[model samples]
Target: MSEHKDNAVAETVLVSSSSQPSQKVRQTAPVSAWNVLVQGIALFSDGYNVQIMGYMQTVMAKLYPKQLTSSIKTRLSNSILVGEVIGMLLFGLCIDRFGRRVGIIATTAFLVLGIILSTAAHGNTVTGMFWMMIVSRGVAGVGAGGEYAVCTAQALESADSSASLQKRRGFLVTISTNLAIVSGFVGSSIVSLIVIAAYGNKASEGIWRVCFGIGIFLPLTIFFVRMSLLDSSQYQKHAIQRRVPYMLAIRRYWRPLLGCSLAWFLYDFVVYPFNLLAPTLVSGFTKNPTLLQSVGWSALINSFAIPGAIFGGWLTDRIGRRQTYAVGWAIVCVLGFLIGGLRFPLRHVFPLFVVLYGFFQSFLSVGPGDCNFLVSSESFPTPLRGHFLGFAAAVGKAGSAVGTTVLTIALNSFQNQTKGQQVLFFIGSSISVLGTLVVIFMIPNHPATLEEEDSKFREYLEENGYDTSEMGLVEKH
Candidate 1:
């Protein structure tokens, strides 16, 4: 048994018998197609619920005609953000200790619960429905917050630990990010068609309910599919010992935790307001009163954004994380300056601005928590990876909550909606510029491979005066 253990650990690349003695070769495992599809589907839920709210805002405005104050409107929309913070924190911790499969399944359940609760609320009074919307959105937000961190970590870890896989990691992760933006387009289209069909030629009071109720179907399908999603390959090792504690992971991986958290803070500060309030901005510009019309336009805008997201991810892999994200900021600055200063009234200028906004927004979708999976999954050894990711997720969720709350305050403080929209665009753009600088200067230029990271961890443990011999690797004196 001891000899077998030694041989397994000592095994190196096996050259083919046909190869010359001087010929050197490498062996790599095949990528799992099933795993990739499962990962994509699992991640779809994250964007599905969040994007639906963007389309649902106009419906909400009609349902609560009197409560359109910036503060109330912002609060109702951001309530999900608050819940997402909690869900991100909880799932991160649970995934580390319990397993990734549990975290994914549990969060999906929250999404289903939210849809059910939201649907039930529509049958009640306006105020009752508002509170219900708040609760449901919160549940959906929590699920989203968890899904972002866990899914990225799971997918990256499953790939071959080689330079080739490292290069492709960005692309694989991009698939989920790109699809999520596309989901916004899908949600918008669905809401548009439903609203138009249910009350064709005249908007009805119940159209919003129908839209919210439709959210239930996706989550329900996910619930059935998720049952078969066992723990990811990365989590199996930690799942067995049950020895890795959440607190220990936090103490051990503080550098990555801090870096990921701060980066997400800046990204979230920008994304939350922009995504949740985009439709509102369109309405402010277009003066369109029809919910179906607003949703259709918003959907069209998001479809344009999806390509930008795919492009950003490709750029991340081709250039590097820092340069790719920096370019995204440059685009944001250009778009922000124009949107803030330009006053277009349905001329070609307005549509052009809308298209630009959608295009630049894709960069943000990649920024917040997208590639941090590389950092989080590789920063810690297999034993502690899940906990670190979960903690970072919680931090990101907190930033989103802050952004949402700030937007609520900004809009509510002003009596005019136009002023509120301008304020949001200005703040979101400014914060993004600052964040881009942080990523450029503060973050390391390249990701560390597994062996490099393990060696660094040993050094870090030595410097901090902790014994890491049980990590099954040598330690620096």
Candidate 2:
């Protein structure tokens, strides 16, 4: 009887209540400022864990000299992507089925275990280290899979309650995404500085362990700190209502799922190349040590890339969703294509290219990463929201896995071979360009709020000649 009431409440909230002016005014009311800090800090941990490995190559190489062989090096480098694949699939299911709170706690536990295992990988035995490294990274990946979807969803949901307080929902929700990028930059900087300070000219074998140890520390800190916050009210309500099962989202909302999956897939195809493969790419291009200077340079470049995200968010509010997406994507296509193909012989020009690369890459990653959650969260009612997010994340991770594998293949095929980076540049840029076009044409350009989203989506389908009501209505399954 309670569940039915919960469902009725959810339907009312989704279909009509959210659109009312009173709700919007209430949404604008201030939330506890502390909540924002906790969410933002947790987001930093997410970015740190996801991208930390990129800067730890030298230390890892020293610790596991034997496994640093060509074949194994690529696998080790790409291991997080492999783990992320599993995390995306598993956590996606858990978040939808178990409740967002449960998924958050579960993913945090994974991060803790991942930290321990990653630390253990610095041990003397190669087999133990290899397997443990893989296992640990996979754990982190699981947490990452949970982090963006749940965190962004929760944040947006919270922001929604206070809607009249702030007109810019995109700006508010994107705080976590922006902070994550900043944290990633800071984490890489710390790792690089530690290596440089510890080793001076020649760092010892244990330095990578220190770096991983340091990387592990941030996420653990975040988990403990985050334990105090309440679960998203939206998610809590859904958990109470139990409106939809996970399987039904696949059967019912498959069109939005497909649209989201394709859009994210293409975005990830390019993003993983940089996020997972930047250090490796740098190693191939120059004879520089794969640590301090290279990572530092990338981090510095990324710092300048902040505007792309801020601008994307700002533009989304001013010009509308589709136009903002269209503008950013068009830049990505043009700038991305030019970044690789037009090579400069002068050594100094490489830094400029790196900055440009990071700028465009940041735009691509940040924009869609935010949109993925925003769109998925608003498209479904509270009951199936988690599942929709999880499904999209799972699909996105598959694309990430493919992108990482491609990077490894590209590296192996062109290792020490001349013009290898040029080829990669071409491939990466081309993917971004193509992805931009796909998003422009395929994705629904609707605001991701409960009141506006369903109506907008229905209208779009009617205009586009896709009859969703007959094929299968998106009911509370």
Candidate 3:
């Protein structure tokens, strides 16, 4: 009985008599600032866990010389992406099938548990310990992976719920998603610095442990916070929770899925290899630098993305998603080509090389880094949102996995160190050019308002003999 009433209330709060989200409504809606905060910090947690592995490589090497093999480093780095691929597909289907809050709650718990295991990793032998850390981080990766799908849906839905929010949804969602994750990247550096300094710059067994452990706090806080979260109005009204028509959704959105997935693939393929292996890059560029020094440089470089994220957020709203995405990738490609072609000369002025490299990182955050979320999240309707976003993100992570793997193996195999870097620069730049084509040719230009998509989606569904009227959520009492 209460479920039916809740459904009725959802309609009143989220839609007009037109059975579409009402842009004219001026009153408060179901979504609150609290909803936005949880989603943002949740992403921040995801960022920290995934990125901390990069800087932690040095810490691991210092603490365990023989145990930290090239193969081990690569596996440890890509474990999170592997877990994410699994979690994204699993929770992606679950969210659309079961519900959003369920996925959120479960992912947080898994994340917290994974952190605990990784932080407390122990073994009779050092090899066993590294394996423990790898598996544990993978488990946490699952939780973090689940967070991507649910939090994205919730953030956009929160914005879609209210008239005022809808007006600024593009800016709010884009900035929040991009900056929050980048801040995580930055936070990993900050936390590593703090903990390393706390240990008097020693790469003790404690350093890596504390770094991984600290990631648990945010997800732990969010886990409790999400316990009280309700599904959004739009989701309550039109979510296809039962017998989801996968074939029909595919027929309608296959092109977008391919395009969005490819863009993300190209983006992550470049971003992750460079990001996770930053310590190695910096160390190779300079005289033997301490782990502390490499980590500090990485912190500064990651922080440079802040301005790019801010600018991209505003630009996506001002121009358009595809245009902003194309411009950012183009700049990255140009800078990468220049950096690769001039690697020998740039290495002379290490600081100058760092600055130019920072520019490359910054521009990526401007478009592909940030806009990928908007392009995928905003491209689909609420019913299919979680699944498609999951699939795209999973593919993107796969790209990261493949890129990270090939780059690491290639760098390790190269007789000439310079040659290895040239491959990264030239290959990565060329991939960005392809990503630009994917964006231009494949990514559709979404309407100004989400309402337009939802309306069109409903019309399409109803016309196809799907029971649009029976599509709303049936909440628990």
Candidate 4:
């Protein structure tokens, strides 16, 4: 009799919640194309800075050959990721507590400052230069890290606010984010071309500085634009007026939080190490390739990401998030194993390996890589969106840092370059397989409105007899 009564109560609550007409009504203004463009540009600094480091690694290695040991090089590569982890944690809270605009300006300011410092990093000794750059890049990474959380949350939340955009939210958000990657590639290419033209077959001490200097223009421009931008209506209406205790919010939604964080961690763990070390990997096969050749290969590999991102966006909206991830990860894992295991003659078919690697890297952007941002932003309530997204991104950056560090160590441990590449590929493949399992079993598919998600959470709390009086949670019905 008690069980029957409980079922009846749940049924009653469901019916009552479903019957409310206002629950379906959209409250926020439609997001404009201009908003999306600005948001995408604001995030370009992150992509540009990340890509710049990969190229800079090769240049620094050449210029400071004796001082730039394998261990120090790994640290240099991982520094930005470390900074990003910190930035995401700090700015995630600020964005949720303060406002989206405030977080944007503050984080972008950090990026600009970091870039300026990086460009100016010069020391009397090689050790001083190495540490100075590592510190500067890490500072820039903080800004990039914050942008990953705050900008993504802002863009998605803004898109969700619009009734017209709710259906296409996945595409808009993914494209906007992926544009950063594209811009990073294009920007790095241009910088590399200029450096090559100016200092062909010569070691230019200041060439890397010029590359870092060019990044400042975009972020500085975006910072000013962000200053005048309004906070998203979803955030202002749903979250701005209320304050949810961070710990309590986490306690309530720990499951989704873990899902988002771990999935992102796994995604970054595979992608970042591959991207950061691609030039070095290619250099192993190519005989005496110039800086231009390495940059060209990296750019060629990155070109696939644009189409992959678009396809992933379409797949996310069409097939649901989990399916997209499963398909993409499976493809990447198989390819990774094949690339690692293939014992073909190195010279005749090495280019094939590079192409296959690029193809799998592209697949990553389409699946977990793209959806991690979407799922992280959508899986939580408005009040907790920024915080959760930041936490997840921070975890992901942590994975990137760890992956880069560990993989670098693995590569250095092997005497033969081919053996090192094989080992790294196998490790990446295993990590992708693990990530696929997590996405399938742990993360729930979220395709509903923020209001609907909020209602479900509140209904669950009520059904479980949890008190909501102190949560500042508005009753949807």
Candidate 5:
């Protein structure tokens, strides 16, 4: 047994040394600025659709008052997230097994169709319209969920394939992933302003339909652009021939999978409720805010997040993924505790509270908000990249669903709305504390490049007596 172990280790060393190429060959398709922009814009559609709904919810409750109770409104808000969880799981498998192109096209179609249905939803009864919108939003959520997986995977893998861009991969990928959310916030703000200006008092009845209608344009543009995209070259070279079975991939990489997924879960659970309910939270402080006022404030809050994301991306490249998250989460934890404890004193100057909340929220985009996807995209090998990313993302969406639903219920349970918000903030702060610990102890430090990580993985398999050739890996030599 000892001799066999020694021979296996020797063979692993020989294979690695022999396989080193004289020059690093581009193993993936050429990544262009156009490719990055298109993927980023495609991702923007998801954020626009998701964030727009938060603004629309205030109108929805009034328009369908007979049908939309507080409970039903919560369901409407959460429906899309629940659908997204399903979409991620399904499309993750599709992208991994068939191809990213297939996943992109199919998911976009679902998104477009769902948007159309939602825009046109009407019924004689409020109940009918309510269910129709709920179902339609859920369907749209599926497409958005799938987009999160494929778009992030494409951007990160494309960046990884280029040796020149390897050191900046975290920043590039983070920008591409996060820029969309900022765009969505800005877009939603603009639309809300337009609708409020156009209709004044009559905005509630029609503004939401217009917002959903606007969502169709970007996905339509993305569909046409996606037709021209080539599959990831790394996927073509490594995973195309011998696609790892999903179960096998899970069994092999459960550690990184759990780590990435839970980190995302904790991050989303804290952020989504705060963001999605921002308009409502703002309304609680100010009396009878107009649609523009609510969405405008929410957008202003989100605008601050853009710089944090940009900074976080650069910071990730500077200090490494783990340390960036630790710092960001620590800041959030401290702010969360302070704000939750001092809700009454801060209520007198609500704008100050908004700024403080926005600042802490921005730190999330800087830390876990950007890093979750970055770490998820980087930590896994190509064959199982989609599967792992999708699973982790789906888990994150599940956190969103819970955060929106359970947290809403918890907040409503308290007689005083301010106290309830305090409790919610306390919960979010506690989760961030846990997230900080998880980042330090669980996730491994990423390699400088994807190629290096893949090389080490192959070496591990060889040393463990796995047959590399049988797994369809070309010997690097």
Candidate 6:
């Protein structure tokens, strides 16, 4: 409206709704709540399946000691991560290109099929069975990975689509996605413990099979629910199913893109390996290192991350995503170095070790674990949201694949596992300190709205000789 305001601009609005909260909520909350709920289950299923593999590997190692080696265990554990990397990229592009609905339905099917296949995995030899399981889980992983792109973006867009939901967008997205993820991790541990205890705490053929089977429950229950999901208003209003301006997006958004991707990469790197092996770490120092004992303790460790996510989500809404992320990383960096420094003294004190260890993990959740999803989804425009979010998440999952391998390698390299755990603390801390700096510099503090950034992006495109007309009111057949 004014020539004086030249560059990309948006007015910071506290409340976009002119009507009463109840009326506004009644109109908008159903679809928003539906998306969050189903996606929560989607994330829950993803986390449950992804996490149980580590426990499966642990059980399989004990069951078929002659067949399962460190190499095979590592391969088994990383298979899903590798599959997730593939799924996120492919589904993300497709979600942007086709529609979010297609991606959601397809990924859910993949998750269900993969879990079913992995559950019933069989072969002539024990090693063959393990390989079959790996391939099966990898297939499930692709579905899980695609959920990161499809589900997260869908939830974020749902929040954006509603005026009533916009203010609480950060918290809603964080709780619905990240909290579900952490809960899934915790659920896997609990489920594994219960299943193993029922099977006499002995790693056997049935125990591994049953563990994989349970992952299918959430996904199977939510399949029809996912089908019921219509594309969000943001996707509808801004869908560019035709020729997308990829070069324009990269040119305009590269800095924040780099920041979000690196932040996600670093977050996944620390959390996936550490959370997966929490049992090993806790058991290293515990006097009673029973299968049930280690996994039960691991469940406790995973549970601590939940509060951090809850608080981080609330804080992200109040303070800002970048600020909350930075604070979390800052605390994590300090706690990690302290943990590494005191590894010797804390070796004997299991309670203190867990308190510190759990706190460290909780902060990891606070930082990139929860916030990265918000940062990735919120920082970009809605039309191309799936593309960018998927790419960033795919990059992060790639880091997770590498991190899991490296951590396992580090654990094996150390004659004393304690030393390996200490190294992990140091490495996690070092990465976190870098993350704090990156958040401060690269990550932009985006305004709270469904379309603030999207509007700016649309204007930027129209100005640059790109067709903005192709972006609005797109109906999928």
lDDT of each: 0.60, 0.59, 0.81, 0.75, 0.77, 0.81
Candidate 6 lDDT tens digits, 157-231: 767655567778898899888998989988999899999999988778888788888888888788888776666
- lDDT (Cα, tens digit) per residue for candidate 4, span 244-271: 5555566777987897788888888888
Better of 2 and 5 by TM-score: 5
Candidate structures ordered by TM-score, highest first: 6, 3, 5, 4, 2, 1
lDDT tens readout by residue for model 3, 173-220:
766687899999999999999889899988898888889889988887
User: Model 2: per-residue lDDT, tens digit, 251-361?
Assistant: 556777777777677667766666655555455447866456666655665564456666666766666655665566666766666765664441357667666777766
Candidate 6 backbone overlaps, count: 0
TM-score of 3: 0.92
Residues 1-477, model 5: lDDT tens digits = 343222221212111111333323333323434566678888877888887887787677657666778767877888888889988999887887766777888899889988999899887887788788889999999998898888988788667655556667888788888767666766777776787678774546678888889999999976877766655555544453343444545666788889899999999898888887677666677798866677787888777778888899999999999889789888999989988998878888887898888888899888898898899888888656788899999998888877777778888899988888889889889999999988888888886666555555656666766555644233445
C-alpha lDDT (0 to 100) for residue 270 of candidate 2 = 65
Off by over 4 Å in 4: 1-31, 240-243, 343-347, 458-477
- Model 1, span 1-477: residue lDDT tens: 343222222213221111223222222334333444456676665566666666666665665667555555666667776777777677767666555666767887787787778766753656666776787778877776777656765665544244455556666666654455356446546665666667773555566667667666766676666555444333332232333344544676666567766766777676666666666667665665566667766666666556666676677678776566667766776677666655343234676767667765765655533444444454465545655666666666677778877876787677876666666677777877776776666555544344444455446655766554443211123
Quote model 5's TM-score.
0.89
TM-score of 6: 0.92
Where is the poorest 10-residue window by lDDT in model 4?
A: 9-18
lDDT of 3 at 476: 28
lDDT at 245, model 2: 35
Which regions of candidate 3 deviate over 4 angstroms?
1-33, 474-477
Query: Global lDDT for candidate 4?
Result: 0.75
Model 5: CA > 4 A from native = 1-30, 240-248, 461-477
Cα deviation at 225, candidate 6, in Å, is: 1.7
**Model 3 residue 95 lDDT?**
85
